[model samples]
Each structure stands twice: as structure tokens, then as C-alpha cells.
Target: MKVLIIKTSSLGDIIHANSIISDLRRNHADAEIHWLVEESFSSLLNLFPIQKTIVSKFRSWKKNLFKKNSYSEFFQLKHLINKENYDFVIDLQGLIRTGIMCRSLNSFGFNKNSIKESFASYFYKNTIGVEKKIHAINRNRLLVAKSMNYEIDQNNISFSYNFKKDQTDPNSIVFISGTSNDQKKWPLEYWIKLAGLFERNNYKIFLPWGSVKEYEECLTIYDQTTNCEILEKMNIDQLAKKIASTRFAIGVDTGLTHLASSLDIPTIGIYTFSNPDLTGVKNTKTPAFNMGSLSNIPLPEEIFIKFNDLA
Candidate 1:
């Protein structure tokens, strides 16, 4: 069977949607799976069993909708989808943009996760309703299982990846401190103190940054501590490969944090100014802890103790 999954943009959601591919592959081992994702995030889909990735630069289109080049590229994508004639298309991203994509193609199914725009379901031929309280991974899994008419074994949930562990440092702990939201960032002082604690525990700290601001911040933290190194900017694929081999990671609410957790590392997700209940780290074979809240910041000691005990 030929299947197309439309999940666009944002690294965390794409990571969450990977479980569906895992479930699908188990049931239809030979099926040709295609993913429609934003151009920036398309690299992530390469790690899965997807046969093709339909790139949609929504951010670009939104910026220059009136441009002739944008119009031409948009229509070309639609034509390309029609030509493929996929037997089934699932819209995991139930936004107006993705909803429009589903409408352009002959959509077979769509999911209504907690964050979905209610109006997006209007375009779906098959609407899959998921309970709001479940973790994002489970929500995606249930959506795929019900939509595809198969039962997903909750006890066997796993996030599939194509990374080989190669990090030489056995006692390396990754700290992911970059988040787009300023509110979600763990205080720099707290990270510095945490690094001190990790150093005392004989663990090297590895900080990965995506933006210049994050890079500068990581540099500052590196300068302030012992054995804390700032990694060069990495694309999604390179970062994923490195994270897979790391000993453990403690990160704020960010995509890389979610990526580390998805790899089944002993990842710690620190949530501030947000609710971990809806979007915290979920899938992991080892210890994964989500700590802190908006008004309540997790202490450095508590973080280290949790790592020592659970990880």
C-alpha cells in the first residue's frame, strides 16, 4: 500500500509523529510511506522508512504569497501530489495549511490532537479523534492505529531512529538550553550551577546551540564553567546522530530536548512557563524526567539527584 503522511514544521511534533511510522511499518512492512513536511524539517523524516518527502516551505509562502515564483512553486507541489496518487494520505498536522494540503490531495485520514485547529477537520474524509490528556506520542499512535484500522500495542511503543552511538565520552551529559521562547529558557545561572554539580560528579557537559543568541549564551556558560564545551551549530541530522550516543541529556523545552528523549536516552526535560503534561518528554526506554513549572523553578540539586537516582 502507498501511504502519505502530512506533518509539517516544528521539530518536536515531527518527532512525536515518528511513532506512527513505527506502528505503520510493523503492520505494513512493505508499504511505501511518504511524508509531507516543511522544508526546514524535511531532513528529520530521512531517519524513518519514508520513501519520499514532499517539501512545503510554508514560512516562505506566507511571507511572499503574491510573488509569481511562490505561486508557481505552490501549484507545482499540488500537481506533484496529484501525480503520485497515494492510496492513503494522513494529515497529522491539522492546521489550515495542512488542511489545505489534504484538500488538494485526496486525503484519507486526519488527526485531531489537543492543539489542532477545529476548522482543519472540515477537509478530512476520515477524522480521527484523540483524547486530549494523553502524551503527544500516544496521541499520534492512537490516531494512526484507528485511522489505519489496526491496533497499536501501547506497551511496545518505540521511537525509531537511524543513529549509531559513537560519542567516545562515557560520562558526557548533554545540556540543551536553547529554546525559541525566552520564558522557557532555564536561567543561565542555574545552568552554570548545574554544570558545577555535574563536574563534581565527574561528567563532561556538552552544550548544543542552533541560533547565534543560543551560541553566544552557550559560549558564556562554557567560559564560566570547567569541562563545559559548546558544540558548533549542527543541522538536524548531525545533531540527532550525536545525541543518540550521548550518555544523558538535560534540556529545557526545546526540539533537541524532545529529540534526545525520543532516542530513548536518559533525557531530562525542564519545563518553565509551560505545562509538561501536554508536551513533556514521553517516549524513552531509559529514565526520562520532566521537571519544573512557571512559578516553580527546579533546583540544581534536585536535577542532579534525579539524574543520579533515575538515570
Candidate 2:
């Protein structure tokens, strides 16, 4: 069987949708699985067992929609996908733009009531209803299982990755201190306190930043804590490799935290502005802890206790 899974943009959501790949592989062992991902995140697909990785420059194309280059890229993508003649095309990212990508194929997607964008349902030939309140990972799995007519052994779900640790530091902990939203970030003082606690225990803390502002925040944390070190700027692939070698990870509501959990690393996700029930670090293979909630931040000591329990 030939399958094309469409999930583009945003690191965390893509990671959530990626859980279904294992399910697909188990159900259809002979299936040729192709993934359609945003250009920036295409490298992440390399960690998974996908037959083909289709690149979509939607972020760039959206900004240059009126230019000929955008039109040319769009047509090129359309031609390439249509040529594949996939037997099953599933749009896990249920948005208008992704929905439009499925218009020419025999596609499946979330129903109007299940998806935030009800209008996107019109493009899919078949729509499956999944509970929106569940964790994003389960939602994706449920959609695929229901659409493909298979039973999910909820206990056996896997986010298996193609990672081989080069030189794992058993006493190293990664602090994901960067988030796209300011509201989601834990207090800088809290991070420093947590780092100090880990440092006293002889665990080295590594901080990774994406933007200049994030780098500055990391630098501040690094200065405040004697054991904290700011990591060099790295792309998704390089960062994933670095994270795979860590002993543990404690992060805010960011994509790298999810990446760590997906790698089966014991990860604690700090949530201050978002609800953990909808989208939090969760994996059956590893210790995934979701701490804090909207307007209710977790204390540094509380996190340290949880880390001790996991450690």
C-alpha cells in the first residue's frame, strides 16, 4: 500500500502527528509511507522510518504568494504528489491550506466538529470524528486507526526514532528555556533555581536557544547558574542529536521538549499558560511529566522533587 501523510508546520504539532507512523508501519508492513512536512521541519522526518520526505515551503510561499516563484513551487509540488498516485492520503493537519493540498487526492481528515477549521472538512472525501479534548498524540492515532479500520493497542503505541547515541552524558540535563510565546515561559528566576538544584546534585545543565532573544535569556540563566552552559545555535537535526545524548530534559511548552519525549527521554514539560490535558509531553516508553497549568506555575523545588523520583 502507498500512503501519503500530510502534516506541515510547527514543531510540536508535527511531533504529535508523528506518533501515528509507528501505528501505520505495524498495521501495514508493506506500506510505502511518505510524509509531507514544512521545509524547515523536513529534517525531523529523517529521524523516523519514512520512505519519502516531501518538502513544502508554505511559510515562505505564503509570504511570496503573489510572486511567480511561489506559484512555480506550488505547481511543482502538485505535480510531484499527483505523480505518486498514493492509495491513502491523510491530512493530519486539519487546516484550510492543508485541506486544499488534499483536494486532488482520495484523502481523509478530521470532521467539521473535530477540527478547529470546520471549512477544511469539505475537501476530504472521508472525515473521521475524533475527540478534540484528548491529547494531541492520541487524537492523531485515533484518526488514523478509525480511518484505516484497525484497533490501537493503546498500551503499545510507540514514538520510536532512528537515533543512535554517540556519547551520552548520563549526568547531563537539557533545559529547554525557549518558547514562541512569552506567556508560556516559566520565570527566569525559577529556571536559575532549578539549575542550581541540579548543579548541587552534580548534573550539568545544557541550555539551547533558537532566536537572539532566547539566546540572551539562556545567557542570563547560564550566568546565574555555575553549572549551566548555553549550547551553540543548531538546526532541528543537530539539536535532536544533541538532545538524544542527554540524561534528562526539563523544558517549557516548546517543540524541543516534545522532541526529547519523542526520543524516549525522561522529560518534564513546564506549562504556565497552556493546558497540559490538550498538548503535553506524553509517551508510554519514557517518564513524561507535565507540570503546572495556566496561571499556576510550578515551584522549582517541586520540579526538583519530581526529577529525583524519576532519576
On lDDT, the candidate that comes out on top is: 2
- Poorest 10 consecutive residues of model 2 by lDDT? 154-163
Flag regions of model 1 displaced more than 4 Å.
104-115
Number of the predicted model whose TM-score against the real structure is largest: 2
lDDT (10s digit) by residue, model 2, range 1-311: 89999999799998988889889878888989899999999988888888899999889989998999998988889788889999988999998878888887889999999998999999998999998898889989988888788889755657857768668799999999899899999999999999989888899999999999999999999888899889999989899999999999999988999999998889999999988988999988889999999867999999999999997
**TM-score for each candidate, following the candidate numbering:** 0.94, 0.97
Which residue segments of model 2 deviate by more than 4 Å? Answer: none
TM-score of 1: 0.94
Per model, state how many residue pairs clash: 0, 0
What are the RMSDs of all candidates, in order?
1.8, 1.2
Residue 159, model 2, lDDT: 85
